[model samples]
Every structure is written in C-alpha cells, then in structure tokens.
Target chain A: MKPILPFLLFALLLGFSCSRQVQRIETDTTIDLSGRWNDTDARLTAAELVTEIMGRPWLERHVSKTGKEPVVIVGMVENKSHEHIEAEVFTKELEKAFIQSGRVRLVQGGEKREQIRRERADQQNNASQSTMKQWGLEMGADYMLQGSINSIMDAYNRKKVIYYQIDMILTDMETNEVVWIGDKKIKKFVKN
Target chain B: MKSYLFTLVFALVFCGFAMAQSSDQNPRAQQAYEAYAEKADNSHAASLGATVDKTYEAHDPILIKEQRREDRREFRRQLRLERARRPIIQNNPFGYYPYW
Candidate 1:
C-alpha cells in the first residue's frame, strides 16, 4: 500500500506539471527563469547604449558636418555568445530605442528592405500611377549599426560564472569609419 | 550723388544681413520633407548616394580592445572628477573617521 501511494503521488505531480498553468503577466516584468540571456537584458542594454550613443560626439559631429539628423539603419548583430540568442530581438530593441529618442532617423534594412522592394514592384503593376510607390527613391542609410555578442564562461565544481559582452558600433556607410563604439557587459553567477 | 551712394551702401548691408539669416536657417529638415512632396525620379538614382553594404563582417577586435581600454581610463578620470566635485572632509576635533 505504501509503494502504491508513492507511485500515485508521483503520477499526480507529473500530470499537474503536464497541464500547463499560464498566467498573463505585464510586458515590463523582469522574469529571469534561467541565468541565460533574456529580454530584460536585451532591453536594458539597448536603452543604456542608446543614451551613450546619443550623448557621444559622433552624433553632434554628424549633425555639424551634414547639417542633418543622420539616417541610421540596424545592421547584422551576430550572436557569438555561449547560448543561442536571437539577434533580431536585440536588434529590434536597439532600433526601437533609436527611433524613440527622436535624435536620429531610422531606415529599414535586410529582409524587410527586400520586402519593401517587392511591394514597390507589385504596386507598379496593380496600383494606380499616382498611388504607386516609386523605385530607387528610398532613404539611403548614413550609418550602419552592427555588433557581436560574445561570452566567457568560468566553471568550477557545481558553480558557473558567465560573462557576456555585447559590442555595438556605428560606422559611416560611405567612409567605413567606425564613428561610435559602445559595449554592455552582463555577468551572472549560477550555482547548482 | 551723396544720397545715391548712401542708398547703395544701405542696400549692401541689407543684402548681407538677409544672406546671413538664410544661412542660419538650416534647410535639412525642409529638404527631407520636400523630397517626399517632390517625388524625385529614380532616373539618376544609380549615380547617387552610397549603398549600405557588408551584410556580415566582423569588427577589428584589437581596435575595439584599445577603444575599451581608453573608455575605462576615461571613466576612471570621470569618477575622480566627480569625487573631487565634492570637497573632501578632514579630521576635526569634534569628528572621528574624517581623515583622508
């Protein structure tokens, strides 16, 4: 009877876990289930970097030289970290921060740029002449923002220390000059 | 003849002032807005503006390391300046643990 009771309790717990209980939470909630990279890290890093990037002399220099708010486009952000991190999520956050600051102009790039071209092509065929979007009239991005995510892990016994470094750079599209460089470091200690 | 010369000088001064005012008014914002309104043709677009390239290229690590090292140095200097912004307290007869 005792053995049977233990088995029944185990089965009940397994069933309860199998039946997922999901509760809606606020978007701003910092829920770190694992010590791995998360949305909060991406968001906070982006927000902090935006302030630094905007405050840097490159922004003022660009304005002074060009007499315009430099048009920036989010480029490739390669994830070279230990875990599988979605680079798009971080890139989107960076783009969002730039746009929200209202300091620099933002433009679409990558797959989205292709999608826009496809739409323009379609419009040429279907839409009226007046309403159809023109070709080759797109805003040329002045600066390309690219970076890499790298990590160094130190593990001893059952404890692990993970350090992630996210480096972001802004380069002149025409000159290939790295105008601005910013980095964010996140270190977490996990013990088992 | 004197009145005519005076009128010419006045015209030149007014013209210079107008030019300075026009230059002060940055046209960048208006130019971008007008680009939309004008709907510029793509006929010569191929000859204009640099294209965004290098879909994926690694950054120079050495240069970045140097930049980071410089940044750390700058940050330390900033911290020192910030600390100095507040006057340091010295040991007094009425206070303890104030020596620095």
Candidate 2:
C-alpha cells in the first residue's frame, strides 16, 4: 500500500491535469501593443487616408491641368512618441499610393534629391550631345508632405494602456499653405 | 501529493512574475525598456519603410552588437547627467566635514 501510494498520487495528478484546459483570458485592464508594425503597412494606410480625403479634389482642380503627374516631395516626419518610430516608413507607403493613383507626382526629399538633380545637371553639362539629349531631365516638386507621431500611455505593473497618433499634412510649395491633413491613431491594451 | 506538486508549480510561476514586476519597477529597468521600445519602434518604421521600397534586409548581428556597445556607453553618459540634475549636498551632519 505504501509503494502504491506514490503511483496512485502520480496517476491522480495526470488525470487532474488532463481534465482541465488552460484558458487564457485577456483582461480589460491589460493592453497589448505587440505586433508587426511594418513600414509598408503604415505608409500604405496613411496614403489611402490621404487619397480618400484629397486625391479626387486635387486631381480635378490641379492634376488634370498639368496633364502630367505633379511632382511632390515627402518632407520631415517627427516622432513625438515614447517609442522611436521612424515616420518615413509610413511616408513611403503614402508615396507609393499617390504614384499608383496616377493622380499626382512624387519625388525624393532632402540630400538624396539634391544629389539626383545635381547628377542630372552634371550629365547634361558634361555629356556628349547624343547622351545629353537622351538623358537630361529636370523635374521640380510642386508640393511637400510632412507629419508627426505622438503617443499617450497609462499603465501600472502587469497591465497597460497605450495609444498612438500619426498626423500628416500636405502643403503647396508655391503657396506654403497646408492643402490636406490626415490623422490616424492606434490603441492597444496589454496584460501580462 | 498532487496538490503539493500543483502548489509548487503555482508558487514558482507566481515568484517568477513577482520578480519580473519588481525589476520592471526599477528605474534602470524602466529606462532599458523605454530605450528598447524606442529602438524597436524605429526599427519597425525602418523595416516598414524599406519593405515599401522593397529594400528590406535582415538585421546583421555584428552591426547590431557594435551599435549596442555604443548605445550602452551613451546610456551611462546620460545616466550621469540625469544624476547630476539632482541637488548636490554641500554639507551633512553625517559627513565628517563640510565641502570646500
């Protein structure tokens, strides 16, 4: 009976464990902000929102007049969140969306842009007549796109609440006035 | 015996969680988590941006390690500055003598 005691106990434990399934219930008190926040996704979403608001009007009023895609530069995107988020990733998505819409034009911002323009000009100045005629193209951006990221968080040990806000604005370069503004927010609750 | 085993497992899990909570409460741990979260967020943005351009690449551990070393040094430097922000003591009853 003494020897059987241990075996009986072990069997009982196995049976008890088998009888119950572990249930993972997310509490209202907890916030989960863990996931893949791919740049492409952020950009694409931002672009869609922009297009929905400004694409049609901009196209009808200005884009149609040019008969060519109007070139625009994506400008500075600031991160004001606790997380060091790169605003450009989402900007890229917006860039692609505008391009795909075929309603407007897009150009690189900053030093990258200056380098491209300079290289083109240099090629034009230095190249043989045939090459210069073949490849010298000068394009100017008509507008600038800019945005900021901000976040709010409240939590105690084992539970948290987090909210993120991304705001973007498009301005006419010639006028220096904001033409379109877009905002998106993501909120999450996680419990540990 | 079964209940005893269960209690032991429960205790271990509870203790592990308690330790984690305590560590997270520590100022150093909070700073580390914030730093990591910031980096993670930026990396996400970078990865997302690169992916949009179809230019995303896998992280290089060697580069990451080198960067981390620099980050650690910067973190320590920042900690010193933060510590200095607090009021300094000129003299105290516990001290042997006052400052010059």
Candidate 3:
C-alpha cells in the first residue's frame, strides 16, 4: 500500500510534466530546432533573391530599350536537391517579387495558363461578344526566369551540415540572351 | 486507514494541478517568445512607423489571416521534421514511406 501511494504520486507528477502545451507566438519567431528548411529560410531567401533580381542592371537596360516594363514568365525549375524541394514555391516567390517591385510584369505559365485559355475559350462561345476577352491579345513574355535547387549534406553520427544552393537565370526569350543571375546559398549545421 | 489513502490521492491531484499551472510559466519559453516579439516590434516600427512597444494590431484583416496561415504551416513543418527524426519503433523494416 505504501509503494502504491508513492507510485501513484510519481505517475501524477509525470502526467503533469508531459502535458501538451500551446503557446501563441510571433509569426516571425525563428524556431529551427531540427533545421531542415523552414519558413524563415523560405522567406529570407525569397526576399534576398527578389532584391538581387530586381536591383540588377538588366531592368534598367530592358526598360530603356523597350520603353515599358518587361514581361517575365516563370519557367520550370529543376530540383536536383536530395530533398523533395518544390521548385514552384521558390519561383512563385520570384513572381511575387516582380509584381511588388513594380519593375516587371508577370505572366502565368504551365497548366494555370492553359486553364485560363480554356476559360477564355468557354467565354468566347458562351458569353456575350462585349464581355469576351480576345485570345490573340495575350501579352507575350519578354523574359523567362528558371533555376535549380541543389544541396550537399555531410553527416557524422548525429551531426549534419547541409548546404543548399539555388541558382536562377533570367534570359531574354527573343534573343535567348542571359540577362541577370540570382544566386541564394544557405548553409545550416543541425545537431540531433 | 481509508482517510489516509483518500488524503494521499487528494494531495497527489493537487500537486499535479499546481505543477501544470507552473509549467506554462516556463522561463526559457517566455524568453524565446519575448525575443521574437521584440524583433517583430522593432521591424514593425521601422517599416510602418508605428510607436515602439505598442502591441501589434494589423490594420488589414487579410494580413492577419495570411500571417496566421503561414505560422500554422511553419508549426506543422516543425512537427513533421520532429516526427521524421524519431527512430522507427516497430519491426516493419521496409520503411514503407517512400520519401523517408
């Protein structure tokens, strides 16, 4: 009976210690306990890449030549990284940057663009003539931005050093000329 | 004899409740949260020209919704990473998860 009392007391204390806790924290709180890739990494990389791609000489040159903002379409990003890193996520960040900077125009690509086309086709047949958007009036993309996500990892016991390198290239679609290059490299040392 | 046992049980229950209350007042957790909050406040002041140390309130509802969504995503990602790090407990050796 004495042992039972002590055991029950200990169990009660353990339960209290192990109780799940919820704490509301700041959105920007940088909590990288395991540190694979996190929101902080995504956000900082996107912001930095945007600054790099927008502040370059290509924007001024293109604007001076064309007398208007250059239209850019995000092309396919190849993921050569070990992890299943979605390339669209990074590309979408770049697209958002282009619009926010007001330096360039963004055009949808891939399935989304085709979906819009399908809708336009539907509208042409089903809707009134005045409300229908013209197909041929679509703005042609002046440049295509593409990139790759590559990573290198070194592991020894419970420690690991992961280095991710994202390389982006902006090319003039007409001339196939490389205009701007944006590179974001992140290295993290994670200990388990 | 019955009264002693009842007293013991009641004492254990009370102790547990007290501990649960104190757990939330964890110093380390509070410090980390305050550090992040201070940084966010500073950035807010510099960017939006808001008064320093004022509790942040988003003027736009869309911004608050987006921030909450992003924070939830981050929390889920951390949980997933933590789970992945744990050793497989069972005898199944195929590691059925393709990506793992």
Q: Who wins the DockQ comparison?
A: 2
Model 1 chain A poorest ten-residue lDDT run: A81-90
lDDT of each: 0.76, 0.64, 0.76
lDDT of 1 by residue, A71-186 (tens): 99876666676577665666666677778888899987665666688889999999998999988788999998888778887766556677888888999997799999998888
The TM-score measured for candidate 2 stands at: 0.48
Q: How do all the candidates rank in terms of DockQ, highest first?
A: 2, 1, 3
**Between candidates 2 and 3, which one is better according to TM-score?**
3
Runs of candidate 1 exceeding 4 Å displacement: A1-19, B1-100
- The digit string of per-residue lDDT tens for model 3 on A49-127 reads 8889989999999999989999997775666765666555556777888888888998876666777889999998999
- Cα error, residue B37 of model 3, in Å, equals 56
**How do the residues B8-99 of candidate 2 rate in per-residue lDDT, one tens digit apiece?**
99999999999986775556876887888877743332221221221223243444567999999998887777656755565765753322
**CA shift of B28, model 3, Å:** 71
- For candidate 3, write residues B31-99 as lDDT tens digits: 887898877742321221111121222143344567999999998898778678876556668755333
Error of 3 at B53 (Å): 44
